[model samples]
Target: MTHGNTSWQEFGQTFVDQSRELNQKVTDEILERTERALVSAKEKIKQTEEVNEILKLRVEKAEQEARDVKALLSRPMREIAEISGDFQKAYEQQQQILANWILSQKAYRETAVQLGIAVGKTAEEVQDLVTQNANAVLENRTEHGNDSNTNPLVKEYASTILAIRKKNGEV
Candidate 1:
């Protein structure tokens, strides 16, 4: 009876030791898997943060470039506007000059007709004078090519012609 009880005790001890060993192995495997998962999660978070930072820098650079482009465009736009204004002013002045020239020619013709002293000779002389005057004006305009401002005398003549035209309903 004593021998049988001793054998049973030894058998129970071996079984308990085996069970404890198996439990320790399972706990070690779980701990290892949890550690791997934690490492992988940490790496993913790091990559995401790096990508976000890169995107932020790119956006900032783009915004700066947009501002630079806008600044560059503004100068040319303002210059174009100024050039357009100058063109308009030049056109108006040219029109005024044409009107005055026409009026002056009409007045001269009327005066010659009233005097009645050889109209043919007077007309030829007046034509020569007008041609010479036109050439002189062209030469002067070319010489002072940079002058964009209207001449006061020219403006006065233009205004007188405009008034005359208005009175005659010829405008």
Candidate 2:
């Protein structure tokens, strides 16, 4: 009996030892896996920080470029406004000169007609004299090479009289 009891006690002791060894191995594996996970998490955080810094720098560069473009465009925009104002002034001056010239031409035509009528001639005769005088004026203008009386309106009026006379077989 004593021998059997000692053998059973030895078996029990071996089982306890094996169980402790297995528990220690499992604990070490769990610790190693946890350390690897921590290292991977730290690497991910570092990469994210680097990317954020690069994005910040790019944003700053874009803002600076936008400011530079605005500065460059300002001068041309001001010049365009100044040119538009100058053009308006020149256009107004030309318009006034044209208005005065038209008024003078109208007055001269009316005076010439009145004078012809007061010379004791029939209306038709006076008209013919006026036409002849206008033609002589045009000839003098062309001979003298004067451009002042060669405006489109003056040429149009002369051509109208010439056409009328030709149509009436009075040319």
Best by TM-score: 1
Per residue, candidate 2 scores C-alpha lDDT tens digits across 7-94 of 7678778788888999899999999998999999899899999999999999999999899767655665445445567655766677
How do the predictions measure up, each by TM-score? 0.39, 0.39
lDDT (C-alpha) at residue 59 in model 2 = 96
- Which stretches in model 1 have alpha-carbon errors above 4 Å? 1-8, 78-171
lDDT of 1 by residue, 16-104 (tens): 99999999999999999999999999999999999999999999999999998677557754454455676557666776888899999
Q: Global lDDT for candidate 1?
A: 0.67
Clashes found in each candidate (C-alpha, N, C closer than 3 A): 0, 0
Model 1's TM-score against the true structure: 0.39
What pairs collide in candidate 1? none
Query: Once superposed on the true structure, which residue ranges of model 2 sit more than 4 Å away at CA?
Result: 1-8, 77-171
lDDT at position 124, candidate 1:
61
